[model samples]
Target: MSRKEKTWWWVAGIAILVYCLFPIAWIVSVSFKPPADLNSGGFLPDNATFDNYRTILTGNAKDLFRPALRNSFGICLIATAISCLLSMFAAYAIARLDFPGKKLILSTALVVAIFPVISIVTPLFNVWRQIGLYDTWLGLIIPYLSLTLPISIWTMSAFFREIPWEMEQAAQVDGATTWQAFRKVIVPLAAPGVFTTAIIAFFIAWNDFVYGISLTSTDAARPVPAALGLFSGASQFEDPTGAIAAAAVIVTIPVVVLVLLFQRRIVAGLTNGAVKG
Candidate 1:
């Protein structure tokens, strides 16, 4: 490539990076700013303080933030686990076995994944209320499955298709039972895909706002994203923007850590899954 082309590409990459990271940087800046400086019209706070963190961690807002964090962790973890497990089996079958209506099944999953979530929220709200699952952990988990399961099935199925069937057959020929062969031979090879799917599923469940807001009315089952809307300041007249910013930063930490730690696996899983199928 010409030097001009290389320079333009570098400039474009830097611009995109800044565009993406600016919001996160702003949020982190706001989190550290004192309440007085929150609206000071500065990118960086002049009198940054840990007070916002302190307040949300153990001050007045603790009652709201802590429990919501716990609920988010529990609900997202459970939903991700269930989604990955069910998707693994379903995807394995779809990838390996020649079954009737296979293309139809894949198409259905694609349709569900692309469907507008808002259209079904009303129906789900009424149904959950009737069945007494409203405002419960199970209530959130069930609806989350609908969101996470389809993409997970598609991702895992693509990954499964890349695995060699001969490995499982070799294990079986060695007198290993079907279950043993699957557990020992198939699972380890699929670990990266499973882990990637779990991360994606967890993110979907964690970040969902429409369901989180519409389904739960209280802290009992409301995740962090929904609960953020209900956060109050020290007094009724005060804005909770700083505290909210701090809480947002806190919630974002886990996602950043997950991505940093498993970035290579995530990239491999996504690229391979996209290409192989």
Candidate 2:
């Protein structure tokens, strides 16, 4: 590339990075600021302190934040596990089997995935209440599956299609059952895809807010996103801005760590067979 082109690319890359990271940076900065410095109109806090973190960690908001954190972790993890398991099987069938309704199945998943969450929440809320699922962990997990499963199936199908068919055929010929070959051979080879799908599924369920808030009236099954919405200051007059920012930063930590740790697997899963070998 020409030096001018390289310079322009560098400029564009830096601009995009700054645009994306600026909000996170601002949140981190605000998290360290005390209540008094929240309105100081500065990018960096003049009196940086740990008070906001403490507030959410061990102070007045502990009861609200900690339980919600647990709920978010548990629900997302369970949802991701179920989504990955079910998607792996369904995707394998879609990719490998010459079954009827293959196109129809994929199309249905696509349609369901694109369906608006808001449009369904009202009837879902009534249904859950009637079925004794409202304000429960299962309630959130079920809707989360609706969000995570279709995408998981789509991504894993792409990965499965890329895997060499001969590998599974050889395994089956060597006296292994089809299910055994799939479980012992195909699944391990798709580890990167599985990890990628799990992270994506977890993120979808973790960041969910509408169902979290709409279905649950209390913290019993309320997730971090919903709990963060209900954060209150000492009194009605006080704003929970710093506490909210701190909680946001804390909630963001796991996502950042997951991306940093598995970024290579994620990239590989995404680009596994984009180009012909």
Candidate 3:
């Protein structure tokens, strides 16, 4: 490309990055803004402070925010773990085995993944309440598997497919049972893809709002996203925007840290799985 073209590309990329990051920056700014300056209508707070953070951490909103934060972490992690384990096995079967209805299984997972969450929430709501699962982490985790499993299976299956058959055959020749081969050799090789899928699954479960709100009635199972919506002002007449912003920033930090820590593995997994072997 010409110099001008390269420059334009750089400019365009930077612009898009800024555009995507602007909202996060705005929220961070709002989180630091004093309540008195929240409506001052500037990008940066005139008197930036950690008062909003303090509110959620130790002030009036602590009770609601802290429990919800714990719930989010617990539920998302459990859902991600279950989804990754199941999908890893399922995807391995799909990629390594030639079985009847394999296509059907994949198609069904895709369909479930794309199916609207709202349509099923009402039914889930009724069932959970009836089964005494309402307002519980398990209740949310179960539905979350529906959201995270399809993509996990598809993504992990691709990684499995990219792995050479010789590796498994070699293990078997050395007296490894099929299960042993899979556990000791195949699983370790697929670590990048597994990590990638786990992160994606965690993000999906963490971001879930419909199920969190519909199935859970109290702090017992409420996640950060749902609780953020129901946040009340420090006082009845005041706005909860600052506190909410602070909580949002706190919620986002973990996701940022995760991506930063795993970006290399994620990229390698994605690129390796992009094409079938």
Candidate 4:
């Protein structure tokens, strides 16, 4: 490529990076600002304080924040585990075994994945109320499966298709039982794909706001995103912007850490699955 082309690409990359990170930078800056400086419209506050963090962490807002955090962790983990487990088995079957309706299953999953979530929320709301599952962690987990399972099946199926069938056959021929061969041979080779699917599923369950808010009336099962919407400041007249910013920053930390820690695995899993399949 010409030097001019390289220069333009560099400029474009830097611009995109800034565009993505600018909101996060602003949130972090706002979180540190005192309530007085919140509306000052400055990129950096003249005076910064830890009061917002303190309030949400140890003061008045703890009641809401703590339970919401717990609910988020519990619900997302449970949903992700369930989704990945079901998706793993289904994906394995689709990738390795020829079945009568295999193409139909994949097509159905695609349809479900692309279906508008809002279209089903109202019906789900009534059904949950009738079954008494509304406002419970299990309530959230079930719907999340609908969201996570399709994509996970698609992702892991691609990964599974790339695995050598001979490896499993060789293990079987070596006197290993079918289950033993699968457990001992297939799973180890597919670990990266499984981990990547789990992460994707977890992110979907964790960040869901529509169901989180619409289904739960209280903190009992409300996740952080829904809880953040309900947050209030010291007075009704006071803007909760700084406190909300602090909470947003705190909520983002785990996602950032997960990406930084497993970035290579995520990239490899995606690229390998994409190219091989």
| Per-model C-alpha RMSD | 1.8, 1.0, 1.3, 1.6
Against the true structure, candidate 2 reaches a TM-score of 0.97
Ten contiguous residues with the weakest lDDT in model 1: 268-277
lDDT of 1 at 110: 95
Q: What TM-score would you give candidate 3 relative to the actual structure?
A: 0.97
Tens-digit lDDT track for model 1 on 1-277?
Answer: 9999999999999999999999999999999898788778999999989988988889988888898999999999999999999999999999999989999999999999999999999999999999999999999999899999999999999889889999999999999998898789888998889889999999999999999999999889989999899988888878889999999999999999999999998887777646533
Q: What digit string (tens of lDDT, one per residue) describes model 4 on residues 127-165?
A: 999999999998898998999999999999988988999
Off by over 4 Å in 2: none
lDDT tens per residue, model 3, 209-263: 8888888878998999999989888678898899999999999999999999999
Candidate number with the higher TM-score (1 or 3) = 3
Writing each residue's lDDT as its tens digit, candidate 2 over 1-277 gives 9999999999999999999999999999999998888888999999999999999999999999999999999999999999999999999999999988999999999999999999999999999999999999999999999999999999999999988999999999999999999999999999989999999999999899999999998879899999999999988977899999999999999999999999999998877887995
**In order, what lDDT does every prediction score?**
0.92, 0.94, 0.93, 0.91
Which runs of model 4 end up more than 4 angstroms from their true locations? 273-277
TM-score of each: 0.94, 0.97, 0.97, 0.95
Judged by whole-model lDDT over C-alpha atoms, candidate 3 comes out at 0.93
How many angstroms is residue 124 displaced in model 1 relative to the true structure, after the best TM-score fit?
Answer: 1.6
Q: In angstroms, how far off is 187's CA in candidate 2?
A: 0.8
Model 2 lDDT on a 0 to 1 scale: 0.94
On lDDT, who's better, 1 or 2? 2
Better candidate number, 1 or 3, judged by lDDT: 3
